[model samples]
Target: MRPALRTRRACRKLATALMASTVMLAGCASAQPAGTQAPASVSARPSPEATGPVAAVYKDLVYRSIDGTDLHLDLYTSAHANGQPSPVLVYFHGGAWARGQRPESWRGYSRFLQRGYAVITVQYRLAGEAQAPAAVQDARCVLHWIGANADRYGFDVDRIVAHGTSAGGHLALMASYLEAADGLDTPDCEGVPRVAAVLDFYGPTNLAQPYNGAASGRHPSVVRWVGDGPGAHDMDVRMSPLTYVGPDVPPTMIVHGDSDDVVTIDQSRELYAALQRVEVPTDMVIVPGGGHGKFPDAEKARVAGEVDRFLTTIGLP
Candidate 1:
């Protein structure tokens, strides 16, 4: 993983240097499940250097997973608030579960860090390295460890949100919809931790469907994660968030690109509808022609605005 640097600029030249390879999204819609729009004055595209009264300080740590991989985390705590740790945001980056790393792929989330919030940019074992449930298990362990070590970091006990993009989005939603552990017998499965909320960005809700072409071409990563492909995927129902539904879930916010070819709009749409059907507080924002995270300026701003509203509505302070 690459090192994370503090950004004082609004738009970054680093992200622009490499164009991600993926199909582009055409149009996406906004479906807010809660919260009113922000006042007209807030600049949607503010720089990382641009923040309110809150001042941010960045830090790092390693949380061990079930497989013993030294999962890395980039934590940002507010400098303006009391010297304490404050609310922590556990964030996972999107790269189809096989690509991406903390701080290397995402720069916009520093906004959360600036708000007197401790933001965690973490890395888990990829699909190829370990099969399904391993990543989820690792994520669960990190959350519990973060909560367990709250005193060490001065972390606020009540505010720990699971946030992610693309594949990361799927993982975040899973944190809410699925059990913290794989099953009843897994080690350290005792006294598992749950998230306060879920923030999903263009994530695929159901991986049972093949991607790119057939199951082997585009969905090999998912197949590897599940330890099965196509017909065999459903047997790993324990890994799917959709399989576990009952009302004990935290609020959820979903953002997707309507034209996204990588994860498909139906993925987010299906999740939003399912969450609403079950009366789980949820929001869905679909950007027009926004394919993947490399969206145009206007669309990206809108997505960020939607996220801001979601977090504030849930009382993330």
Candidate 2:
């Protein structure tokens, strides 16, 4: 059998066995809301720096700023969604919350666009700019911005989803689980809308758990992101996506590679267990020998299929 097929079959077997054994488990973008008028300083068109073809695209739309540094987002759709609001997928890039830029390959998301989904890629303040809560706060802000301006962007506020890989995955989960009352608020984004679903790719769910990754605990980069000193432990719990898991978390799909040495497989496993405990709708797809984000093309295709089914199951188009 082809490697992808073999991987898919093994994953299915693993999922089935886990379900029978434990009854199991679970489980961007910067555009403003639909009708909120943009300030004169914000531009609605793609910046000159935006490259590649897309049905329609907008870039560097400022969502928020801290200490005068503007955080922006890029949005794309197969066409100008006019008549009806389209479903929105908010993507956060993975760089251990310390580095990484919003993905620039418009074509990389063609499959989702062809499936009638609008993609919104967001840039958050990284560890270099700030620290742990800052990225989470920015993530929550992006969701609220989408809701406040859902009409302008032609997306259903109720149909917004979060997708991310690695550290980005943790942020995506936080976007879905963090409560507005829990201090994820900003002057502009006071409340966070419910996340429709979450797609997590090999994300570290629990910061408290030691995973063998460059971003793991007390690593200079992580310490910088989470802040240093005696209170770091408390801060770690607060920033952990795993800490936020509860009944209110939206439906979720988690894909992890069993052989992943970066973020240990146990991270996802523990999360799956947590969601299962809460009886949340959750699914796990394990690539038998996959690495962090480097799965075979066939395996990637399988993941795409899983995403489609998960979205549809959660009532998204």
Give the top-scoring candidate (lDDT): 2
Q: Model 2 scores what on Cα lDDT?
A: 0.72
Q: Which runs in model 2 stand beyond 4 Å of their true positions?
A: 1-54, 80-82, 211-221
lDDT of each: 0.60, 0.72
The deviation in Å at residue 89 for candidate 1 is: 1.1
> Least lDDT summed over 10 consecutive residues: which range in candidate 2?
23-32
Q: Which prediction has the highest TM-score against the true structure? A: 2
lDDT per residue (tens digit) for residues 137-255 in model 1 = 55765676676677766777677788888878877776655552324113443344567788888876766554667635336656555554333433233344554544667888888
Q: What TM-score does candidate 2 get on C-alpha atoms?
A: 0.81
Clashes in each model (backbone N, CA, C under 3 Å)? 13, 8
| lDDT tens readout by residue for model 2, 18-51 | 3322211110111112223243223346454333
| TM-scores of the candidates in the order shown | 0.74, 0.81
Window of ten residues with lowest summed lDDT in model 1:
21-30
